[model samples]
Target: MFPAFAKYRQSFLIGLQSNLVYRMNFAVRGFFSLFHLAVVFILWGAVYSQNESIGGFSFGQTLTYFLVMLVMQFFVGAFNEDYQISEEIRSGLINQFILKPINYFSYRFSIFLAARLVTGALILIPLLVAVPLLKDYLTLPTEAWRFFLLAPAMMLSALIQFSIAYCFGMLTFWFLEIQGFVILSMAIESLLGGQMFPLDLLPAWIFNAAKFLPFYYQTYFPTAIITGRIEFAAAIQGFGIQLIWVLVLLAVNQLLWTRGLRRHTAVGG
Candidate 1:
């Protein structure tokens, strides 16, 4: 197990080091994410200027909500899905990966996590430094224990998202390409998963329907916990929901991977 982990460790370190080498491009990506923050602030500010509160969210709370959402997005954003996974599957590069004793899922996931950490830290450092200065007006969570609990929750959220995404990307084994599928999935996640706006702000029926779907567990509930929008009981319920969805999807991925491997017929292999 150690040897297998060592291989993945090496891959993750390589990805981390490579991200550092291209730090300028990463900085630019961070800047682009800030545009989303700006747009949300402007759009929501207009709406709030007319109304004191909408859907139980006060003006200040809504602003803080968007800020937390934006920051969470930057922290958790993964890279282009199809290019990373589909390319390997189509080009038979994945077969090379199979030859190694290392687990393919672990290798891919570790490298991706490493890269995300490197890039996310580049953006988060400034936010951390400036957050204290803005604490007077901004209402961030004051509970240190909640912040501590958030670390593992964040990791679990990222892992669950990546597993589901990579499983879909693995469909390139049969689909031949998955760019269109990737776009559709992202669109659904944004609209149905509360990535664009608070789920509570949506229509009651729509929000109820979204609760049954795995999308809510992606960004909404976790961010809610971080923002103190959810109390202890509610947070536990949310975590349970997330855990169940992760297990279900993980099972699906296992089934898909097994089927894919059986069907895979590359020339060399």
Candidate 2:
């Protein structure tokens, strides 16, 4: 596996270099995201002025959760990847993967991983600079053990999201236009993946249902772990559930890849 990864390693490096050239463009994009943060703070601040806590979080803790979520999104958010992958599939660029020794999924994953690193690094610049200003609102995890669990949870979240996006991208094999499908999927993810708000803020039944879905594992689980909203036992259980989702998504992606390739070969060629 190590020897095989050497090939994808080159892809990783190339992706990193290519992304580096556009650092300023990406940096500016990250800079503008602060405006969205501003709007959130104002809206939530108003809401909190009326009440001490919403969904068991004090105003400060709730804001901290959103701040942490912003950072988590920088790390694991999968956007444009579906479009990119679908474009490649539609344009027959994947023919090279079949012809070459490289695995298409591995190649794309390495590159996307590099992209996430570059994006996360760029976004952190402004965030770290703003740290002092926002210190009053942000809260760090209380226990060192939470940090330990956080690392793997973050990785699982990344894999879970990427696998789902990849599976959506691969659907290009069967459909001519996947925009509607991809958009619908994104709407669901944003609603359910704790992108809009912590799932704990939802009604009991809905929150409980989300726990069984892969969406919550994407953003909510890790953020909840860091925010101390979840107990140690719950965090450990979430870790296991997240890990299982990763495995399940991987299996599903493999199945999609197998069938997608067959469809592509028969229809495209």
Candidate 3:
């Protein structure tokens, strides 16, 4: 069992090393991300200009929000694994993965984490270079504990999202196709997950309701914690919400994996 995880870690490390060997690939990704940042800046800049304040967020505050959002985006936005399960199922690769002497979840998770490390580093360097100019607008949290607590909170979000996404991917066992559904989920999360705008800009009813949803904790709550936008009490409550969602997704993914594994009759099996 221990060696199984070790193998997964080895695979992940190999992935990082492989990516490093292909420096141009990382360069291309980083270049595209910079263009994306420019687009976000322009769009948000226009929105801020339209309104004196968008739901209590000033221009600088909103810009800072996007900046932090960009960082979180960099940390987690490498691959879309939603289609990976479907492809594996279609091609019968999943059967091999299951038969291997390893926990499939751990293997998949380690690969995800490893990819994030490489991509995050690639994204951070360029962004950090820009930080000196944007420092006036951005507010790093003053509370030492908040910074410490933020790491695990973000990790929880990453794991929860990966697990839920796997569950969605596992739906491939039942459905022949799931790309449309994946796109829909991505769209809804982007809109409501505080990626485009702060949740505070959303209606009061919607903002309150988001607490129960996983999307809020993904980008909004964690970014708020790091940016010092959330008060200490609210940060605690946000963490609670994030943990609840993590638990719920864990159970859901476990159930999905069990059921899907049983139903899985691979093409080449």
Give the top-scoring candidate (TM-score): 2
Q: How close is candidate 2 to the true structure, as a TM-score?
A: 0.94
Q: What would the per-residue lDDT of candidate 1 be over residues 117-182, giving only the tens digit for each residue?
A: 777787876566445644554676687756876776677677777776788778987898788888
lDDT by residue (1-269, candidate 3, tens digit) is 67766798787887677656755676576777667667876887788777887766676777777777877875765256677656877778878878877667776677677767877787777786667766776656478877887888788878766876787788898899898888888888887778767788778898888878988877777788877667888888888888888888888888888998899886656
Backbone clashes for every candidate come to 0, 0, 0
RMSD for all candidates, in order, please. 2.4, 1.7, 2.4
Q: Model 2 residue 217 lDDT?
A: 88
lDDT of 3 at 208: 85
> What would the per-residue lDDT of candidate 2 be over residues 47-83, giving only the tens digit for each residue?
9999988987887888888888888887988857788
**Can you give the TM-score per candidate against the true fold?**
0.90, 0.94, 0.88
Candidate 2, residue 241: lDDT: 83
Candidate 1 global CA lDDT score: 0.75
Better of 1 and 3 by TM-score: 1
lDDT of 2 at 114: 92
Whole-model alpha-carbon lDDT for candidate 3: 0.76
For model 3, how many clashes? 0
* Local lDDT at 171 for model 3: 88
Order candidates by lDDT, high to low: 2, 3, 1
